[model samples]
Target chain A: MDTCIEKIRTICADLLAKGKVQKVIGFAEGSIPMASRPIAVTSKEDVAKLVFNATCGLNLANYVSDVLPKEGKIAVTAKGCDSRNLVTHMVENQVSRDQLYIIGVPCTGMVDKRKIAALFEDEITDFIEDGDTLTIVSPQKKEKVSKKDVLRHNCRVCTHRNPVVFDVMAAEPVEEQSLDQPFADVDHIAAMDPAARWAHFQELTKNCIRCYACRNACPLCYCPTCFVDESSPQWVGKGQDKTDINTFHFLRAFHCAGRCTDCGACVEACPMGINVRDFTRKLNKDALELFGWEAGLDMEKRPPLDVYSPDDPNDFIK
Target chain B: MNFITIDKKDWTTGIDKSRETYQVFGPVQDENGCQIKPLAPDVHPLMDAGVTVMSPKSVLFPQTQKMLTATLDASIEDHHVMKPVKKDDTPRVVLGIRPYDARAILLVKLNFDNPDYQDPYWCEAYAATTFVGLGVNHPGPCDFSTSTGCGPFSEEGLDVLMADLDDRYLAKILTEKGETWAGACGFDTRADAAESQSLFDILRKEAEKNITSVDTDQLSEKSILDLYEAPFWDDVAFSCINCGTCTFVCPTCWCFDIQDETKHKTAVRFRNWDTCMSPLFTHHASGHNPRGSKVQRVRQRFMHKLKYFVDKYDQGIMCVGCGRCVASCPVNIDIREVCTIMNNYESK
Candidate 1:
């Protein structure tokens, strides 16, 4: 652990001195009890402030495009999942590889905030991490839990523990993990009949308030002008009617079919606790089976729908 | 040596050159800042500083347009009264359109003119309008023309291309429509063939400099079909509120819902935008929705953008790479992240 920190610090200092990067986006120690928050460091003086522990789970890659500079280089710390986004951006031409300095972190897994919250009967005041085990100190109690029990779904079946593309490496790369257990919830839901599926959807969207939080948090929905705002032939109503709401949801799902990387940002941002990931996963599965496409995994591959070949399958087409 | 210069002050005279034959619409400042507005002779000054808050789409497709109206009362004789056709035929020019927007208009033409499915409304509007695409001396925050392969010299769907050359605007009339429009301008010195060719070269270079290419190399229709069960969807969809903001804001999200609206004796049919993010979007009349969950809906959104749209249309629907969805989404579910995740998810 000490070696890891030292290597990170050294990389930061060297990158700064070489004038390779104008900014370094990484996690900083959050105030008091909460985990880590995204921080942008510009100078070598702040290199000591960077830290990467089990608690450093927030996907910091989302900030790369947010704080991009017009000129010069930018460095960022990326985990396996975060590396996928960096690669996607490179493939999509949203970011240039020459301008980025990636510091890759080999992660075992990251804990889910909600799962951790549930483990504590009382409010958690502070938490400490010793490797994969987390020691939580709450107002009413303290508990030590295994990382696997509370690991995010994305980390459970992580196929890429090592960064696919990186400028610098911070730790020995970990082997890909395999899940022995079945996704019981997904299986149970998939077994249901069409009528039951409709009931499930009705219950889910009934709580939607039309607050576009999910769209904002997603890293792929980078269009400058979306379709809904067009008035010339006003495609969708701006009102909150049920039919109008349904139209928005269906089209959005269709739009993201092959492109969703399943980071779970949309579900986490939802205040209603709606399991939005289920729909995206189903479509992701379908996209792979039907077209063999996975969105952020490869930088050289064209998006599944960008090109069409006569030999392509048309089973779903009317 | 004589050097003739034309500035903003010369715009009025320039308008006067063809005022008798053409109507012009240009950018004007509104409460929401600059947008394209209807250019009347009286409101010509409004075009000087601001772009219209609304796009030129509104000029062609009005907000409250009546497709057809019907009467259902027994005493009134069950008959329908169709709305009178309103077409703008007097050749009109929309000035100062950024290259990206010109590309958008071009896309509209391609989609609406599908050989399989034709949109009469868009076709009628296209016939009545002649475009005057302006060069982007400065672009807006939402402009992604350079990244999406759209630019000033785009011949896909345009009539006249005008480039801002510091002192005087370089006008390249590509089509006969453009030449006729240019001839009506009555400029003393006609742009020679060499000058026009040079202008095209300059415009192409400018576009190339701004062009940012999205790597669609790994993306294919078959790839999307292969990863339907991948676990990546659950991880990426965690923050989605199931709001249709992404679809509603998307320029290429064309999914719509048709409804019948009634007010007393009149019944009108209306169509509005629909998104795949909402759970209700896939709900069938029989109460069965293929995309009943947030994960399924989120997956559909990406597939449509990266796969399905391209399947139906030969070309990718051409997302202008606008970042509105990144900023406008309330929970900040960035699409860029989702695409990255999709790119990384491995098949079992």
Candidate 2:
């Protein structure tokens, strides 16, 4: 972790000093335990704030549109999913390939803080990651646990552990896992009857307060005015009616369609601990199954949902 | 004020007895985490749920509250006119509300229960509930409530303040409403006043020692324009995604928007929680949004909480620093960092 951060800081600082890029987007140590914040550093001094760990779960690709450089380029540190989203961004004209200096970081899976916190009876005061061991410190006890135990649900099943595109590599790529059932969670919901599936989705979204953290955190959700916020036409109700909540989630998921990278940014950003990927992951699986396609892997290829073909699947429509 | 010894063995019975008259709401462990929800007949409060991510304000000010109802049918008498929705008016006991959250309810009240105009929905709900606060023995690391006009043990808006004494609870009744609730619970065993006072003081001091403080002295002296035009906001607002997570989780965030929804012939006016982070919060009817940019929306949140609120109310910052936003923020936009920047800004 230390070596990775040192190399990242050096590259970012060098980029800033040489005026190669106006800014270097990276992860900084967060105020809380087992968390890191997305940051943009413009100076060599600010590069000291840069750090990397399993906690850097929120996708850095989401910030590229907001921090796009008008002149030279903006250097963004992209993990596997983030690098994919960056490719998507280039494909979608959100940013040109020339306008970005992608600093690719080979990623280890991010740990779920909720999982770590639940183990201790008291509040967790400190989290130290060394090698493959995670030391969780609390008022009650200080215990070292294997990092594999606390990996986030999305990270546990992640196939892309290395960035597909990069200007410079932060470290050697970690070995990727090949899961037999990548969409097992989706399959569990699919196996249920239509009424039971509806109930499951309804129960899942019953706690949604409509904060839109899930929407905003998504790299794909870059619409100037989200459908939920469109008052002139008002596609969905602003209040917490069950039907309104379901409509908002369903529409937002549909919009992501073939473009979702299974990045888990939406889950990481949600305050309610809502597994919104349930809505989008189903689309991700369908895209892969029907179109034999994965999102953000290629800059030249358009998403299946973005373009229409006469040969497109019509079974679901009927 | 009176102190009562709530024996651990009697706690469940007392709560069950109190529920016969009032709906009991408290921190109950859900599948996700601890939330202050209506306690089912089988459920009991998690005495040390810590600071709930969602606030207790929803007890009095619901996230989506129906304010008015009307019918579109022209033939019916008193139709097509918005009429006040019949309120339940049932008394509720917000059991084990944190002292800071209790104080937050009063901060919200300043907006809804003002002299100029009172919101009947919020005010009537507030009038009906009993606020029973629980003092924190071990404050969380993010909690800076000590410096933000509230402390772990502060009792500004509570009807009764209870202290967790390991084996049992020592409840101090401070109002007639609290006394009535206690009586209903059969919590009549009294503790000596002086002894309980000394214990509370010691606990409060110990908890305060654990918390970090902020400096806001310069904020009162600085002009609104100086803080507004300060150069630090762009960097502060950079990572903000303009999501309402921080505002919605915040106990002190009291903004709401009213909308009338109609189905068939019936219309219902509902007020839902709103946030300064949304572009539509300041959007004009002519499609001119004053705070259109993400930076502008982010700036509004901090300015309102730290500067405008202080200048308007002559009170401390609108934040109690319960640290819900600090813990819940996805991008890690720390309020402590922003508050410090605003507090000590030497505006150019």
lDDT for B324 in candidate 1 is: 42
Model 2 segments more than 4 A misplaced: A316-318
| lDDT tens per residue, model 2, A32-97 | 887788888999999999999988999989998887766889999999999999988888899988
lDDT of 2: 0.89
Q: What does the lDDT come to for candidate 1? A: 0.63
- Report, for every candidate in turn, its global Cα lDDT versus the true structure: 0.63, 0.89
Weakest 10 consecutive residues of candidate 2 chain B by summed lDDT:
B28-37
Q: Can you write out model 2's per-residue Cα lDDT over B277-296, one digit (the tens) per residue?
A: 99989899998988889888
Winning candidate number (lDDT): 2
Q: Which numbered prediction scores highest in DockQ against the true structure?
A: 2
Which pairs clash (backbone N, Cα, C closer than 3 Å) in model 2? Answer: none
What is the TM-score of candidate 2? Answer: 0.98
Q: What digit string (tens of lDDT, one per residue) describes model 1 on residues A1-318? A: 324767888899889888989978776664334355456777999888888776565465666775678998899888887787788777778898888999988888777766786675444667787776778876568889887788877667566777878998999988887665424456667889989987876666754545555554566656543565444465776555667667767776676777777666665544344556666777776677778876777877887777787867765687
**Taking candidate 2, what TM-score does its chain B reach relative to the real chain B?**
0.98
